[model samples]
Target: MIDSHNHTSFSEDCKIPLNEMIESAISKGIKHYTITDHLDLDYQDKRFTFSLDHQARREAIFKAQAFYKPKINIYYGLECGVQPHIIKEAEAVIQKEQFDFVIASMHTTHKKDLYTQAFYHGLKPLEAYKAYINEFAWCCEVMNEFSVVGHLDIVKRYDLSLNEVNLEDVKDEICQLLKIIIEKGKGIEINTSGFNDIFQHAFPHPTILKWYKELGGSIITLGSDAHFPEKIAQHYEEALNQIESCGFENITVFKHMKPFEIPISDVRASLKLDIL
Candidate 1:
């Protein structure tokens, strides 16, 4: 199985070192994965700003790749948390460094951290959902430098009840966003982080995956969004099952910013035999 997203100490919120995180993935039989540390420039919560030591992170990734060569394929990647205000700043960083993959994400709205209660203070659940989804749609429409959009419906992450946020209410905007993603040849990730959370489902949900497929979109990647060793490749079996049911026979894996397909059947069989 290929885990397309993860973080280490390079990210402001995570504490694990890159080598330790890689060792953990290797232990889990994940031979192909990417280290996508966070980089949200000019974020609202000064403490949550996702900046990185570019050269240092690059050196660490290269060292890991050399040590694990032939045994594991470790790709260097970045999870860029974007807002309209910092588009150029994000672009400059992307241009300056070379990344194997770039996962575009929206971690805040109006510079306020979405994970905090302050983001939802005045708005009802549905209101917040609409606003968040619209902001995400805008980002998707405007951003073209990313390989895939991370957690398209991540607003659900903060919702108290999954039922409180209905996709039908925001279907038009979501569809528009999906269309733009497809037109731009970008994809979405099945962020498995939601499985253990109160949301209790993958980000973008299965229905949205079906919608993307129905819209003639096919590129989809899987990510554990792991910040620690234990979280590496979390809930991948369930995610694979859901993607298969959504009519996807293959999943995208990236190398040097280019994506290729691997059959889900192969991944499933490998998992059943404890070989992957």
Candidate 2:
């Protein structure tokens, strides 16, 4: 199986060394792994800076690829924390770096980090959802240097109570965003992080995946979004099942920013995993 999104010590939020994370993926039988560490430029949290050591990260990735050789295929990637205002800043980074894959993620709105409660302060659940989805759509529209949208509905992750936020109420907003993504020729990743959270689903619920497919957004990638060793390629069986159920027969991977498709059956066969 291919794990398209992951973080290592290069990311501000993760301290695990790249080699450890790589060994974990290798142990899990992942044939292709991409190291997409966080590069959230101008992150709101003053306490932390999400800037990446690009050269250092690339060297480590190359070292891992060479060492694991024949055993695993490692690709150097970046997950930029995109916002409408930092379009040029984000693009500049992409242009300067020789990355294999780039994922545009919206971790903040108006420079406020989403993981903090301040982002969800006073607004009602639906209002927050609309605002978050709209901001993400705007980012995808204005930004030109990304391979796919990472965890499109990641705002839902913060709504752990699960009672306040309702994605159905904001379907139109999501549909419009999906159209923007497809129109831009970009894709979305089925971020499986939610499965380990309160959502019990992927970052974007299955319904969103179905809508994406219906809207002709065919570039779908699967990522565990793992930070630690145990999390690599986690819940892939359910992720694949969700993709198949959503009318996606194939999943996408990237190399030098170009996408390639692998049939879902082949991906399933690669891991010898099946849905129960």
TM for candidate 1 is 0.95
TM of each candidate vs. truth: 0.95, 0.95
Instruction: Name the lDDT of candidate 1.
Output: 0.85
- Model 1, position 147, has a per-residue lDDT of 93
Across 1-276, the per-residue lDDT of candidate 2 in tens digits comes to 889999998998888999899888888888879999998888887887888878877777888889989988999899999877788988988989868899999888766778875687777778778888899988888888899999988886776543355668888999999999999899999999889986767878988898999989899999999989899888988888888988999889999899999898988887775222
Q: Give per-residue CA lDDT, model 1, range 1-276, as digits (tens).
A: 678899999998999988899888888877688999999888877666578999999998999899998878999899999898888788888877868899999889866788874577778777777777678778877877789999888876775753576778777878888999999999999999989876657887898899999999999998999998999888878888889889999989888889999898877776666642
In candidate 2, position 252 carries an lDDT of 90
